[model samples]
Target chain A: MLRDITIGQYFPGQSPIHKMDPRMKIIATLLYIVMLFVASHPLSLIVGIAMLVLMYRVSGIPMKMITKSLKPVVPIIIFTSVLNIFFVSGDPLFQFGFIEITRQGLMLAILMSVRILCLIAGSSLLTYTTSPIELTDAIEILLNPLKKVKVPVHELSMMMTIALRFIPTLIEETDKIMNAQKARGADMESGGLMQRAKALVPILVPLFVSSFRRADELAMAMECRCYRGGDGRTRMKQLHYSHRDWIALCIMLVSIAAVLLLNRILA
Target chain B: MAVIKTENLSHVYSEGTPFVKTAIDNISIEIEEGQMIGVIGHTGSGKSTLIQHFNGLLQPTSGKIYIDGEDMWADKSKLRDIRFKVGLVFQYPEYQLFEETCYKDIAFGPKNMGLDEGEIDRRVREAAAFVSLSEEQLMKSPFELSGGQKRRVAIAGVLAMKPKVLILDEPTAGLDPKGRDRILGQIKEYHQEEKNTVLIVSHSMEDVAKFAQKVLVMNRSKVFLYDSVENVFARAGELSQIGLAVPQITQVFMELKKRGYPVNSNVYTIEAAKKEMIRLLEKGGEVRA
Candidate 1:
């Protein structure tokens, strides 16, 4: 059941997005997020959605995957949208007993929902296309300048990479521990909240113990290989910005400029 | 009545994903009561998957599982009770030890069954005794024990539940020869005293040959053979074809028979091979007077 988590999971493929430089993908995702918030007009939102649709098609990730990523955030979307509709004051559109949905409030709610959906889908696309190793390497390279200020950029990135690498391993361990406990008749399901939480003791204790053992062994293995920080470390697969990255950057700039221009003219 | 039965049981992992795999396929078998069955197969031959279904740790993608003639999934709420009825000690079970003391660790299962304090204590002590865990060792934290002792504690945890059917997956894996024999010996003793069904999934054919009354061979996610140990090991050729070999003693006897010696090639254990060797010598008219 834990395997169903689709968020932050890499989807291996040879699609253009998958082949794009990880650094470029990261920049593109951030720019897209910024553009979504900056755009005020519906026409700009349409343009943003259109670009997203085209990117999704080209990435070759199935529609089902994007929908799966969206499933978990449904509650958040509804909660925020409802709050916006009732809390934002404007021309009254629907009113009932000290509760009202205003014209501006309804419009804001719709926009917020769309923005939230697009934000998740766009970011999820980046993760789906970029492998975790490449993502971490790109972050380290991009943040290299922070080292001038005595920031431990390399160490932080190394930590991130190791943590990301161990997610699946830890997940497998948890699955094994859960099954072992369940075989002992641990009732994880069915029970009051407290009872259910109490049932997790058998699973959690074992998992934590195994995790510590794994961490200790991993550290020893790393030390045996003479790994000492990231000083003078060289990557086997070096990052290169190809012509496609330039084209992608140009498209992103043009879209943001167009969105801003249209918003100003329409306003 | 068969203590455990599966009707065309099949398990396909990650079913709807691109990584879909059929771990077990169309396996139908009825394990009789009071039988010690050894499950043997190459890695990924579905040996682990099959035993997991018996205890409801895994639900078959397609098929029915019955624990003592009652459909396991017929009532979802009773699955926990079913799990207690079919105890499973997973591979590297010692890693599941988490209690402050070995006694509490063994008591975890019985406590989960909602047994009274006295009953839980009694079962814990009995299970510990079955595994030969000393009173002092029981008070020590399970984390403080050696790998073999931790393994015994984990197995004791399941035994304390007093399940009708006990299934152990590679219980002796990664243990020294002495540790292996000790654990398997205790399991054999427990089976004899309780007369409960025991299924031991093992890679070592010798261990199974010495203890199992019956053998179940799996090949490519299907039951290759399920019969008496003699019958299963008799087809040494077919067994080897699937990357599994009969006990070494059985192989030696087969070679002896092939060398034109008037020897029965059916011996699978060391003791049986010794008896066969003495019988062959007596038949040769070489008796020392």
Candidate 2:
């Protein structure tokens, strides 16, 4: 059941999105986030949503996976939308008991929800297209200028890559540990809140111990391989910005500029 | 009556996703009470998946599991009782130890059963004794124990529940030869003394040949062969083709049989091979040494 978690999950494909440069994908995701916030008008929001739908289709990733990624943030989405409805004041559209529903408030709520949805969908698309290793390489390269100020950019990326790589491994280990405890008659399913929290002790303790053991072994293995971090490391597959990457960047920039123009004109 | 029976059992992992895989397919088997059964298979052959179904640890995608002639899933509320009745000791069970003291760790299972303190205490000591753990060791923290001792404590934790059928998945994995023998010996002794059904999932043909009366061989998520140990080893060629090596001694006997000796190729254990060799030598038969 825990396997249903799709955070940091990558879907392999040969679509144009997948073939784009990782650095461009990261930058495009950032641009998309900015566009979602900038597009306050309905027309611009429609454009943003359409762009997301187009990317979702072109990426060739399963639609179900994109929806699944939003499942975890459902509560947050509802919270923000409810706040928008109650907090935003304008001409009243309707009134029931103590709750006044304003036209502007209603519109703001819908806009906020759509923006959040687009934000998540756009970022999830980037992760779906780029592998974790590639994402780390892009981050390191993007942060390369910080190296002049004595920042350990390569080490930071290495840590990120290792953490991403071990996520599945740690999840599998947790599953095993939980099963082993359950087999010994630990009632984890039905209990009061405190009782349930106590039940996690068996799972968490073992999981923590095993993770430490795994980290120790990983460090030893890295040392044996003569891994010296961040110093004079060369790339096997050098990152190159292709024509597709330039086209993707151009499209994102144009869309962002259009949203800005529409927002100003509508205002 | 069979202690455990699976009818057309099948499990598909990550169903409805691109990662979907059929772990076990249409597996049907009946296990009698008090039988020592060993499960052997190549990696990902569904040996672990099959045993997990016996205790209701996993719900079959489409199938039925009957324990003591009753559908295990008949009452969802009773699944907890099923787990206590069919204890499973997982691979590297030592990592599951959490309680401060070994004694308390062993008591974890019995305590979950809601047994009285005296009853829990009795079962805890009894389980510890069954695994040959000393009283002093039981008082020590489980983390302080050696690797083998920690494993023993983990096994004792399951034994404290006094399950009617015990299923151990790769119990001897990652252990030294002596440690493996010790744990297997304790399991055999427990099965004999309690007369409870035991199923051991292992990759070691020699370990299974030495202890298990019956063997269940799985290949590609299907039961390739399930029969007496002698019978299973007799079909050594088929087993080897499926990436399972017969016991080392069995291979030696097969070599002897090929060299014109009147030997039983069905011999799986050294003791059995020795008896067969003595019988041939005593008959005054012309044998090439």
Candidate 3:
């Protein structure tokens, strides 16, 4: 059940988005987020939505996956929307006993919900098209400036890479331990929160034990291969920008321009 | 009646995604009570998925599971009860430990079962004993134990619940020869004491040969073969065709038989192979005694 988590999970593909340089994709993602802040009017929102739809098409990542990634955040979106709608005092459109829906409040709710949804979808698109390793590579390059300030850029990236690499491995290990415990008749379901959580110990204990063992072995193996804190280390796959990256950059720039104009005109 | 059974069971990971996968297709099998069943398959052959469904860890995409002829999912509210009846000890189970002490960790499952304190203590002590863990060891944090000790504690955690039909997915994986034997030995002891339907999902033909009386071979998300150890191992070539090899000693014995040696080709365990070799030697074979 724990393995079903799809948040930030990459869907490998050979689409245009997948082929674009990770550094550029990373930058495009940030620029897109920056643009979203200024997209207040419905027209800019429509354009932003259109761009996301177009990007989704080009990326070939199935729409179902983006929807899957949003499952856990449903409550968060609802909570934010409710808070925005009820607490934001304005001219009431309808009044009932203790509840009232206001015009400005409704718009705020819609906008906040849409913004949260779009943010999640857009960020998910980055992971959906790019593998974790590629993202880490992009991050390491993007954060390379922090090295002079002793920010441990290499260590951070290496840690992120290792962590990302282990997600699936850990999930697989969890499956194994769960199976092992289930065979022993360890009840995990149909419990109160405490019971359910307690039931996880059978699964978690062995998982942690094996994970630490795997880490030890992995560290030894890395040391054997001369993995000394990533200092002076190089990658087998180098990141490079192509014409497609330029196109992506241009697309991001257009979105930014549209967001600015819409905010100016709407205001 | 089958102790555990699946009807047209299928599991599809990421069902509607581009990375969707049908890990286990419409596969069905019935496990009898008190049977030591060995599940052998190549990697990604749905061995893990198949075992997960035995208990309620996984629900089939489009099928039903009957635990002792009762629909496991029918009482969804009591799913943990089903989990208790059909225990599963997953692969690399040693990592699941997070409790402060080994005793608390082993008692974790029983506590979840809502057993009384005295009962939980009884189960915990029994489980620890079954896994050969000592009193002194139980007081220490599970994190402080050795790798094998931690693994035993993890297994004990589940065994403490006393599920009727136990399933272990590669219980002896990644261990050295001695550690492997010790783990396997404990599992055997557990099965003997519990007398539950034991299903071992493993790729180790050697362990299966020595431990399991019945073998179930899975290939391409299907049940390729299921029979007594002798019957299944006899069709070693079919297992090989599906990327699974029979026990090495059994393979060696078969090779000898194929070369016109007047030896029986049914040896699985080392002791059996040794006995068969001694028998052949007594019969005055031209080969060295």
Candidate 4:
């Protein structure tokens, strides 16, 4: 049942996007996100969507996987669209007493839904292409300048990496504890709200106990490795931008320009 | 008659995910009544996954699991009834104990079955006695007991259900030598007294060899071998290949058998090996444990 929760599952590949320096990839992902709201017209949103699809393909990750990753967000996507359809104001194209459906409201709802979909799908491409290890490395590099302002960048990134690593381990432990409780005749499924909440105590207690044990072991292991922040520690895989990275950046810049130009022309 | 049987059973995980796996694939095994079955496999070899299916804790992704020759999942409404008949004591039994008092915790399963107060009390006391827990221990908080005592209380919780086929996933794990022996001895005695099917899922070759009449070896989610203890130990070398082995005494006797001695290679216990060696040496100078 927990197999549905997909986080930090690296898609194995050797595509150009995957090969791009993690730093460039991080920047590109941010810039791509910025471009999502750069235009209001349907034509420009189409361009943004097409760009995301192109990036998704270049990431060498399967389209099916991208949708699979979006599954947990499906309810949220539907919720937001429903909310916007009701609240977004314009001339009422269809009126029924207290309810009104307008042309602009309907179009805005569609575009907003697509925007949310593309935003999730596009960024998931970044995570799909770059492993969590590389993503944290890129974050540390980007945050290095803030170290002058006393922002414990290394410690923050280290914490992020550790959390990322333990996500699956914790989930597995949860599954084990859940099954153990299930064996004890703990009725988890058929119950009222209070009964269901009470049933989870057996699972949660064990999970919490094991998680602390694992954390204690991990801290000791890290201390054994002489890990005291990112001080003078070099990484095995260095981040370096190539000519192709520069070309990719320029292409993204051109796309933003096209969206802006289209926005102005349409306005 | 077999208490539990699987017909071409399989469990495929993460069906469409990139990291999909088939934990138990096309496994068909019959577990007869009153037999101590030792299912051994390395970690992640579907040992846990396979056992969870015994009581319908897991619905098979494919095929069927029959409990007492009845389809376990045929009536989804009464699957919990199947659990009462196939008691699964998980690896860390202590984690399942949540009631304020040990008595209430032990009574949980029988209570879930809607048994009467008299029946629950009788089952709880009998199960507690089987685990060598005293009457005083039942009233105390289970969380207050020593780890071994806590483990015993958790185990009795399942035993109170009086399952026809008791499945323990590493019942003696984390116990000291004495604790391990005491617990296993109790389980064996329970099996003798009740004549119920006992399946102990463990990685310890010694424990299985010392007790179980049958051995079921699993490697990479598939049945590597399954047979009577003596028949399986005769192929000790193949067992070692999959990170398993015959009992130490059997290993030595098998070696002696290889060296043209009259030692019995099927001897799985030190006492049996010692007796065989004594008889063989009296006949000639022959065997040893």
Highest TM-score against the true fold, candidate: 2
For candidate 3, report its TM-score: 0.84
Fnat scores for every prediction: 0.88, 0.90, 0.62, 0.54
DockQ-superior candidate, 2 or 4: 2
Off by over 4 Å in 4: A86-92, A96-99, B99-101, B135-146, B241-243, B284-289
Off by over 4 Å in 3: A66-113, A146-151, A169-221, A228-231, A258-267, B98-104, B114-130, B133-144, B189-194, B285-289
The residue-by-residue lDDT of candidate 1 on B133-199, one tens digit each, is 9999999999999999999999999999998889999999999999999999999999999999999
Ordered list by TM-score, greatest first: 2, 1, 4, 3
Worst 10 residues of 3 chain B by lDDT: B280-289
DockQ order of candidates, top first: 2, 1, 4, 3
DockQ scores of the candidates: 0.76, 0.87, 0.42, 0.52
Q: Is the docking of candidate 4 incorrect, acceptable, medium or high quality?
A: medium
TM-score of each: 0.96, 0.97, 0.84, 0.92
Question: Comparing chain B with the reference, what is the TM-score for each candidate?
Answer: 0.97, 0.97, 0.97, 0.96
Q: Once superposed on the true structure, which residue ranges of model 2 sit more than 4 Å away at CA?
A: A264-267
DockQ of 3: 0.42
lDDT of 3 by residue, A1-267 (tens): 666788878777899899999999989988888777678865677767787788898988777766777777899989988887887889998888888889888888887777777788999999988899989999999999998898989889889999999999988777666655554445665669998997776666657667787899999999899878867787899888999999889988987898888878886
- Output the lDDT of residue B275, model 1: 92
Off by over 4 Å in 1: A96-98, B283-289
In order, the Cα lDDT scores of the candidates are: 0.91, 0.91, 0.84, 0.86
lDDT of 3: 0.84
lDDT of 4 by residue, B1-289 (tens): 6788999999988787667899998999999888999999899889888999998878899989998899998999778788888889988888656677899889988887888999999999999999989988899988789999999998898888998999999998999999999999999999999999999998888899888999998899999888998878888889888888778888888778888887667788878988988888798633433
Task: Give a tens-digit lDDT track for model 2, residues B202-252.
Answer: 999999999999999999999999999988888889988988999998898
